[model samples]
Target chain A: MGVVVTSPQFKDNARQAMADAPLQRALGHVRKNFIERRAAAAAGLPEFEALRDSARDIKNHTLAHLDLYLEEWERKVLAAGGHVHWARNAAEANRAIVDICKARGAKTVTKGKSMISEEIGLNDALAAAGVAAIETDLGEYIIQLRGEHPSHIIAPAVHLNKDQVESDFRRVHTHLPKERDLAEPTALLAEARAVLRQKFIEADVGITGANFLVAETGSSVIVTNEGNGDLTQTLPKVHVVIASIEKITPTMEDVAQLLRVLARSATGQEMSVYTTFSTGPRRPGDPDGPQEYHVVVLDNGRSSMLGGDFEDMLRCIRCGACMNHCPVYHAVGGHAYGWVYPGPMGSVLTPTLIGVDKAGHLPNASTFCGRCESVCPVRIPLPKMMRHWREREFERNLSPAALRSGLKLWAFFARRPALYRLATRLSTKALHLMGRTKGRFAKMPLASGWTDHRDLAAPQADTFQALWKQRRETR
Target chain B: MTARDDILANIRRARGVAGGEAPRRAAVEERLARAPTGIIPARARGDAAHRLALFRARVEAASASFATVADAAAAPDEIARYLRDANLPATLRMGADPRLAALPWAGTAIEIARGASDGHDLNAVSFAFAGIAETGTLALVSGPDNPTTLNFLPDNHIVLIEAADVVADMETVWARLRERFGKGALPRVLNLVTGPSRSADIEQTLLLGAHGPRRLHVVLVGAGEIGRQD
Candidate 1:
């Protein structure tokens, strides 16, 4: 992957993340805010749950008819005097955008927050071609200054604290006075606005990611809380939209259904502050808008996901609710996942984009508490998908020798119910007798991983299956 | 094969269907033409008073401010009053919208500038195409009448929402767009703004006014008892 991925080092990264005090402190905010706000927003709308069903159905229908819808969207875009460039992968997508900038003689380009842009490493590509790319989103700008990728999807700099951001601003913004009061997020935001505002006016090309692409009107929709996306696409002469193929929806009404669940699940807003729909470049007699419009639709392994076990993943609207509620994500924060995406969604998707051999550890990191799927707006079975990755890893002999032996040992007993039940009963009886006084073990013979952190309760004389059978017969 | 052809071929190969299947073609065409409205929130369907109340509540909830006026003639005065109250400049930038140009700006002390923003103006105003009650969103179409720049590139933005145009839900707004602009077609841009700009990038603390307007003030004109689907 052109985007430098440490996903293969996820285990080591997660270990280091748990020990980093500053990151741990920053992640506390995610724990406090997203869950309660989303709960309140979802509860406020009586139709919210029903709307999720509608959203899921719409995406399902779109994915089933992806070819026809893409054709219709392309035809409509051409009719609207817009150009559509097809990209088979990240390299093609980046080339299409850079070529557009080169044709327009664009020295600088302003960018809205786009995970696809990050996935394709667009900034590095643009730099290689001698074009400057300025990130206009406040979080993206902060991360761009720090030379970091986004830790979280929606909140790019969520892994950063106020002091870290303040320092970043001081380091980059040299023209400002040294002793000025840059002590607050508010001040940091104001400084970013002033800085990016200049870039927006000077930039010759604007690039943004589409939240959804409407096939009916050939429009690309962007939902943002800050108005950065609006300015990014509006002020520049050339506007280039980079989006994946799965973002296509059949109609505006279908988009409306998805929009209802998107904001509430992401940031707990009824609607994001700005939802702008752009069909093409500036129209005849239009006073202001982009003079030229181009859309770069990227495949990048998504078509393979369409009719496979992971087809449900395409229904995701990138709400970030999964990571927000994921316990493992909360412990290590988003950076430990070490890719453009993080948390439960990343666990499943990473293995697909990059091979399971590289990102196999991500799936095993989950505790499978099911909070992600329960809160998912489109109801993608994230944990189930992760399990699928784990199974595939085992089948491909990618698992370690010890783990393989342990699983094999368990599978042997699992196939023989009578012997397994007798063996478990004898082991439980022996453990119960040995630990009668303590009632728990700080260490076990074969399981040091569980006992390392906390004590393990000793099993009773009878197994749960035996106890259940006795209770039913007694009743 | 071209990238488009390869992608379509891959999708068809996985989906187990050729691209020319009549049933799939008819399904997509039907959905596009009919544009069926999905589940609308219960809060969206209400009486005139309830609609206005919910609109105000949701707008305020989004951290935006709105003032009600009896008619369009009072809109400029409202903008002037809002600027004065917020300790902002009394100057305003706007486009050539006939509805706003016809407003009685001479009745107020505010100075007015016209044309698109080059990122220099501190304040601007625009006429909205419709006001949505479900989310308290103002949908504005792109044109010389109401330049898109006035909507985003300003420190302060004041929008005029005609009460008669305020609708019950987003679905209503979609229906109106189809009727006015024609099915499967729209203006180059249609902006739906719900609140002032904000970001929660630093430590998950949400602060209003990021890159767009620091303050968004809406002048809801003739808002009393003016509600209907049509």
Candidate 2:
């Protein structure tokens, strides 16, 4: 929210990331680590597959009867002395949060990492209204200082290196002595800690995103390694939790089952360091906690997903497991998606949330690689969902006219086996003729983007369908 | 438009596909009634030693320090020495547990505070209620003696642990907690401290302390019946 990088579209962002040698190298290194660690963690448990299936079924059941669960959640929260405000969309959610801040006369707001806040762009609205919003999460704070959106959901500043952070710190912390060495990790942390301590004490309002909402107890769960979340929620007088309505589970047992998969899939840990749950405002005899607890349940296009084809997408716990395993996400990284959410799940959800006009390029970013779906702890059929989005985009006439016509022509022939076989044979002959050397096409009429990065291998003289026909005739 | 109208209008717009009856609610009561009361995995009792070793390796990997003591009485002195060696002051806040409070430390120069106060003055020491061997986690329950502030506000945290209380897995630890406190019970704060506060936010560089304790020291007490024999 500090500064929007509006110059780059999705294509432009992808090109830039691909061209940057350092970023590509870093992506390669980090992506391998995540994939390898997750596989090792999954292999350790025999019931991991069964657990995924069960988790998926539970999420599906809850989402199918979301209205009933939501009502039950609202009643439980209110009974626990907490207030639940329902927001229809981003605008309503943002306006409601700002209004709450205004009523409390809040000047400074501290926040724990909540993707819902990012989805609503709440900080931008708060800053415009003269309220200083501070990101308490270390990763979030770095990105906030850099004036950029989070590139990765879990590790926001995973793309940055030490020197970049050193420069950012020097620019922000002018009070520090110029001679003070910022080369080491210790020094950088000390500087950030000193700065955030003051913000924690001064902030009047605290906001956080819930990892899970236990409907039975009306408690919002936050899992983090650093204790910044605890400080963010406890230090302020008024606490606001912005979460999607689908985050609620029936009971703590359901929460336990989800947590079993959540941490193991995320960072290969048995459990995250801190899994703190808060029911409501500070009770009597409590020494320190928020006085006013407000939970803003933002539907924001998710409720629409409940009974629709994309309902399974709601089961995502935002663990970043699917993104970590995605081939395209590894190649292009998160910024290429050009939205709040990115990666495989982002491809399906973004188009649905923002409409195809804004995010039509997302679904095409995938290779239909089943890696993401295979690794998903909740078993979201990501590739199929992406295909659905592509289908919707074409139906809405959102795609370019030429591309739509090309798809139509291909579909026409694809339906007729004889015409499709004939077309394939002719194209194979033409490709062989064009390739005089070992099969590699430098440029193609329709696929310039593919050839621009690397040469595409030319097809053989005989198509697979033609070979099948010849074999049958000979037999 | 009124507030209710505005809310309803937003809901209508956000709703995806309508016209279908709501799905039938699944019967959770029947499932819970038939579900197993416990699912604790069986392991050899000798495996506790191996689990403790693995837990230590993980804690070290996370960049925390651990030292095994012969007895709880030796822990206070050893901790005082560690603080002194680290250039930290000897002032400490002790938990309310009588076993921890009774440790004789006449030879040690450290001054023990009776209860939790502002941790800004110096180091705070407390006895962990239980140690989880699975994730190298220490459970801290707040009571009259164990003020939650000692867990956070301090720069350095030193925890005393009994070797016998170390459980081999998280499920085992949870079972113990359930037995101690019934289903409806929850403390104001149930802290599961795993290593010291760490962050990789700044350019993906690992920083030991972002906001919480800069250093975490664990004194594993192997005394009396709790001591693990070599």
Candidate 3:
């Protein structure tokens, strides 16, 4: 893979991310904006919850018969004169796309904001192959100029402020007038639009990610607010779509159901500015569209997710709701997750796609607040999936020795309920006697991880079990 | 094994089924053939006039401007008025749509251009295939009639939507598409445009005109009611 997996260093990354003032300023936007907007959009539509259920059922049905649907989708794509290339993993997927671009003698390629492309490390692969890849999405363009991955899935540069973007543009785009005023977000958008417009025309190949691959019509759908995706795919001679295997929906009606909830959940828009469904290459007498249409479907360990507890994860539509509503994500921004995906969805998915060892910290980061599952458009049980990852980590002995022994010790006491109550009673009494004056512990043995960040409140005179038993007896 | 075969085999194994299991295949085939409809929002359901009003309201709420013209003949005057109001140039780019071609451009001083956009035009117009009232979406099919480039490569995108073509929901739009294009066949591109180009990526601040038309002005011909901007 071209992109480095910093997932193993997530704890350190999250530590640094927390201390970065500018990043914290940017993350504040997520904490305040997305939640209110989403609530308003959902409140406006009475059928929003029912539509979420429909979206979930459609995905469930499609996955249950995925093999069949995939075959059918491939047949329809071929019938429409489009090529479908299957990749077992990221490397193969990149190779297929690079070869397609190389065969067309492409020098520069334009790209819409596609998380799958980032997942497969396509831009780096293209750069190594001597092909320039230009990002067209406004947020993606900002991050690309700064040489960074997207902090958020939908809003790529959500971690950046306008000043940072202005500096990045000034630093990289020396061709433009040096004294150009980019004080406002609109000015930066206009500059990016003007710069990328030329690239859109000059590029030989264009690549995009598919939100849904309709099996009935053999079309790939992309939803965008800025219309960059349309420009990316329509301007180039060859349009290459990079999508995961689970992106397929059964029909256009299913696509309709999914789109109804996608924008509302992600950006709180009734609909995005552009939702394009591309069937194949430009037809005869068509004025403008790509001459070659290719779809590279990457499995990348997703097929293995089926028939397992992680199967619910495959229903995810990448709406960014889970991350937006996640308190942990708000506290430390997306870069702290240290991978392509960063939130509740990423916590469960990262472990499966990469390994639990590299991404074990992600699932453990959640507080189990359940806000993600509540806001999830497809109703993916994010916390449950994270617990599944924790179980897998324990099964593989991937967690730290200290945690394993702690859990092991707890399990031993739990098996003997009387002993558990006795041990807890003694510990509560000792803690109460020691910390009754302070009412909280600023420092504590064996719990420095908590005390280092915030004071751990002192235990009461009795444990919760003791209190519950006494209350029941009194009642 | 080839990537395709291996992926399929792995999925089948994971699901504990062989390829072409009769029940599974039948289920998929039936779904594909049936194209079942899910729960559509009640907001899009109403009389045609109410639906058109809803379309206008939603479209305007998305930061797009909407206007009503008496008929296709009045479209040119409305288009000219919009360009003048926005202070854009009198030049307009379009594709070879006969519906738009039949309009009397000679009555106005606006300069008309045709074919795909090469990223230089400031204003472009296209005819929408259908307008969904549920979300105020405009569906434009890519062909000689309406080049896909005009939909994105202009500063001001003016879409001409006929009142008769407006639908109650997206599901109805699908039915219309299937009838026009036939099952399992589609035009090279079918674009569903709602509002003008916008992004909230910069510190979560909403800004318009990011890589597409900053202004989306829809001329709803034969639709009497004007939409209110939220």
- Which TM-score value belongs to model 1? 0.98
**Candidate 2 chain B: 10-residue stretch with minimal lDDT:** B35-44
**Candidate models: Cα lDDT each:** 0.91, 0.75, 0.91
Candidate 1: tens digits of C-alpha lDDT, residues A352-407:
88889999999999999999999999999999999999999999999899999998
Better of 1 and 3 by DockQ: 3
- For residues B1-230, what per-residue lDDT tens digits would candidate 1 score against the true structure? 99989999999999999999899999988898888888877876767777877787777777888898898898888888899999988899999999989999999999899999888899999999999998889999999989999999989989989877889988888889988999889899999999999998888889999999988998799975433222
Task: List model 2 lDDT by residue over A84-146, tens digit each.
Answer: 888877778888899999998899999989889998899999988889899988878887898
Instruction: Please report how far candidate 1 places residue A418 from its true position, in Å.
Output: 2.4
TM-score of chain B of each: 0.95, 0.77, 0.97
Docking class of 1: high
| Per-residue lDDT of model 3, residues A130-211, tens digit only | 8999999988888888888999999999998889999998998899999889998788878887888889899999999999
Q: Which residue pairs does candidate 2 place in steric collision? A: A304-B16
For residue A29, model 1's alpha carbon misses the true position, in angstroms, by 0.7
The model with the greater DockQ, 1 or 2, is: 1
